[model samples]
Target: MNPRALRAAGPAILLVAATLTVFAALAYGGAADPLATGDPGPFVRWGLPVAKLVVNLSAAVMVGSLVLALFALRAGEKEFDAALDVASIGAAVFTVSAGTVGFLTFLEAFNPQLSAGPEFGAQLGSFLTSVELGRTWLITTIAAAVVTILAFAIRSWTASLFTAILAIVSVIPMATQGHSGDLASHDATVTALSLHVVGAAAWLGGLVLLVVLRPVLTDRALPAVLARYSSIALVSFVVVTLSGFARTLSSIGAWDQLGTPYGGILAIKVAALVSMGLLGAWYRQRLIGRVATAARAARSFWTLIAVELGFMGIASGAAAALARTSPPFTETPYSTTPAEILTEEPLPPELTLDRWLTSWNVDLLWAFVAGFGIFFYVAAVVRLRRRGDRWPVYRTVFWVLGMLLLVWVTSGPINAYQEYLFSVHMLGHMLLTMAIPLLLVPGAPITLALRAIAKRDDGSRGGREWIMWAVHSPFARVVTHPLVAAAIFVGSLWVFYYTDLFRWSMYDHLGHVWMVTHFLLSGFLFVMSMIGIDPVPYRMPYPGRLVTLIAAAAIHAFFGVSLMMQSGLMMAEWFGAMGRTWGPTPLEDQYIGAGIAWSIGEIPTLITAITVAIQWSRSDERQQKRADRHADRTDDAELHAYNARLARIAERDAAGR
Candidate 1:
């Protein structure tokens, strides 16, 4: 191999070897055991996890490279091309490894022989076509294959973005596969696993991309690229850490269980993760600035990166083993009630004021999002201040408050009882769509980000660049248009509840995520169109803004009134089926929800309208002040013209008389 290529490939090869060795040892010693009765032999037992390891690593490469490419690397550059090539290779490996896992899984479950018999072929066909698990793997394999081709072919920013998304989606099937025996809380487990896998991949893959691209990058460009990547890595680390903890908690309950083999492996993973985090912090704090300029520092940085890869390998390996490790909570196999069979959580205690405040189901996804959102925002503000830039304190406060409220709504009582109580669901909905955005929009986070983040002048893009692109893009302009925003805001209320979308959110975890995202976005757009301080493609005139607000409020109120007038319960099968003995009947709860929609929901809309009016008044005052300034500059030319016209009319009238 050539010297430069060898240098780039060596670290990754060693890292993979280290990961596989550690993973296989852990899997064999701690968790992996061939099924005693329907044994699929050592091949299936060992091959599955190794396959999974390949899947994980490949996914990281595919996702991380695409993300880094989109965010940091410039198109038509050698570094960008190298990243895409790595992504394509990763996708190819992902495709093959995923298919192998599917085959191994089929062997493990059905113990099918390799004979060319018709019955065997039919059984295989049924497994691939009829079974959900088999279908999942099949789809994932196919998607990976597609991504492989696309990653090789596409190099543009938008295409790479889509490729990244496709790579992330390919892992979802794997996320849904693990811990399947626990049917009741499968949603939580699935959500946690999905987040964990995605986060870990991005974290691992981005670092690997940096290592691979070291040769291609120039000394001048490396630090800025690293800086951009550091943000993504930081966010990825937060997500992984939080999701891993949540997944572990769901499996291992008591503190004493930490002594078990499963817990030992988990501890090892945690230690490795902590070590990597510290290493990352050291890099950011000490080495990130100097690596680009100082020769000795650059060498030290590469050495540190190699060590960090070692730690990442350990973590990744242990994670694979831990998936195979049987949890203590699942060991006892205690009898479960029907509710436990259905919901995966025990029926929550009676809802009370105190319970509403204190209860926690721990939706780690949203919780971490909130936590990181607050942290990064505060960090950005602090960064600005340290550099002698001024940022409004109120924006920070509003953002923090909004995020805290989001956490409460997602992880607290509203989340706990939303499935059982329509009123609580509506309350959460209102908060997500109205109250949260009310605060968040006024916070003007996009503005803060634009101001606080440094502008990237190189061919590459960073957070500030992306944020600017998003705000000014054709899609953004279309969506953020006052009319479009208002239509979406008012239209969602009817479409969400009156259709199957509400029920889908109730039953499906992914659907629930979509619901939250949709509402949050719609609300943000609407609020931004009204009184947002951030720059947009276009905003309506102040009177038009007020008019939009009034129209949206009226439509929103009418939606609530329509709900209040409903004769029957919405999603009776899902919400009504949750057997709750404590609170209102399903119909009465629906009525309460309608009331919340009609009365409480309008409070924010009213506040928004009032805010719009105040903004309108201030806008007019600003216009008048601008006119005065113009008059001062031009010696009142408009007034002089008016006077001339008046004099001419008076002269004409006098002559006629």
Candidate 2:
């Protein structure tokens, strides 16, 4: 097919393919089978998935177009505007589809009579307001509507970026409903499904972007833009692949279960993904460079893009069906104990020396963050080395160590038991706020990034541009300021533990994410203000640094001591109620956690004070060396001039006497 025709037909092909596949899969899986009681009819059954398919496709285009506009296309240009226009249109569709899905879901779930009567309206309103599933879809619909307006109104870089983030977030509620896996797999499933959805959006949407905007992709610009898009697609593919694996593991109980209806749909999706990945990584990748100069390669690449779109349609359709299909079994055994009832997870084996080293429950989000963190850092170092620009070996080591430690803190024993064990939670907090920052600050990641990443001459802002903007942005200046950083660092420790923030973090996933981010960023900023090599707006003298550290440490110690002195358990309903036959009693564990905060936390402060002193000494020695060098170069002209002025004044005074 001609490129123009193919581009126009891409969405149609995907829609038709998805439509065909979803009903067939639904039939085979018995998801659309008649209910034994309170059946909402076939229209409700069929319309929901169709609406969801549109939501998935439209979400992809909206988010993908915005992301591609940021990374791949130049700003203030036709192609860039076109991308935003595409996103706006996609968001509009997403809003409508999501709203339809929400409404249809209500009908399917509640079997409310389709009517405009007050009674029917009241029932629908209660469902939308009172039910979790209803609320999730409602929020998704409203978020999509907001994204629609933002995407239409915003063309500037920052606005478009924020709009893109909102678009991504809008799909999260739907992704959360991806699998009905065990509660044991809740965090992992949620994280993985969210990533898979977002990544697949970018990958599929970028291709749609290329086809739909073919007129603007000039020969000279096409190669570079395609190359950039390819890079984004590659990263997306990796994320999708990994996250899909995690979701799959949670869904399929055993190898034998792969023959089940859910498994059949999963297998089809997997095949589509693998095929798409190969096409993207191999054929399309090779053709992107040649497409500018070679006409045959251009045609071949566009054809391959069409093929990938079909595969995406298959994957998207399969995914929607799989979400509705019942899995073979679940990992959540029936929980009877209070600990299990409250936490939605079984009580881990009693906290012990061996478990700290051995226990693991992977949090995919942070693992991916750390994994990519290490990969890119190493790549930057290699890029510098190849260019004969040397980065310190110790910096690289510290960076890797920091990332490794981050992975462990997030996904290791600390994460597994932090919810159940107060001492473990406090230990993780101290490490996150103090020790990890100590290791990470020395890495000088910002310095390395500025040196390693090439500057973009084009109108588009790449990684370097974004980094510089963020550092110099007003928010950074305020947060990085010494007094502000110190205040937040100290204030948050008190504010978090004493306020409902602690309870929120324990109960809500979003709250937990916010808690971790707040501490890590606050810690990093405080440490950076003190000893980090990265450029900041301001820094105090060495003595002042020491004083600040001392004051913060004193407050920290006081906080710890106060916690230890508390007679009652914090969040007593939670910490006190978990029916654990484990190590220490609740009160004793709280004391142990407070002890960790007081003693172990103070060690990092001591280390920082020592580091400051050593840095001060080294700075002074370097100043003296510079002074001696100046003396050797110019016979101490500055010193001689000062002395001569003093002598002249004395002689004049004597003459006057």
- Scored by TM-score, the top model is 2
Cα error of candidate 2 at position 528, Å? 0.9
lDDT of 1 at 561: 88
- The C-alpha stretches of model 2 lying farther than 4 A from their native spots are 181-183, 331-334
Could you estimate the TM-score for every candidate? 0.93, 0.98
Q: Report the lDDT tens digits of candidate 2 across residue range 1-657.
A: 567888788878888878888988899999888899999999988888878889999999998999999987877899999999999899899989988988898898888778889999888888888998888888998998898888777788888888888888888888767444353567678888889999999988888898898866788888878888888999999999999998888878689999999999999999999999999887654888898788898788888888888899999999889888888867556778877776667788887899889999898988998999899999999999999989999998998999999999999999999988899999999999999999999999999899988898877778888899889989899999877898999999999999999999998776887888899888999999999899998888999998999999999999999999999999988888888887899999999999999999999889988999999999999999999999989999999999999999999999999
lDDT of 1 by residue, 1-657 (tens): 332554666556646755675566555555457566888888778778878877888888888888888888998898998999999998999999989888888888899877889988898878888998789889999999999999999888778888888998998878887664453356677888889899888888888888888777888888988987887888788888888877887788889998888778788889988998998898888988998778778777777777787888888778777767777677323436544544556678789989977887667778878887998899899998999989889999999999999999988889888877889989999999999999999788888888888887787778887787778789998999999999999999999988989878877778988998899889988998888888889989888988888888788889888988889778777666667788888899898999899899989988988998888788789999999999999999999999999999999999999
Name every residue pair that clashes in candidate 1: 184-344, 185-344
Worst 10 residues of 2 by lDDT: 176-185
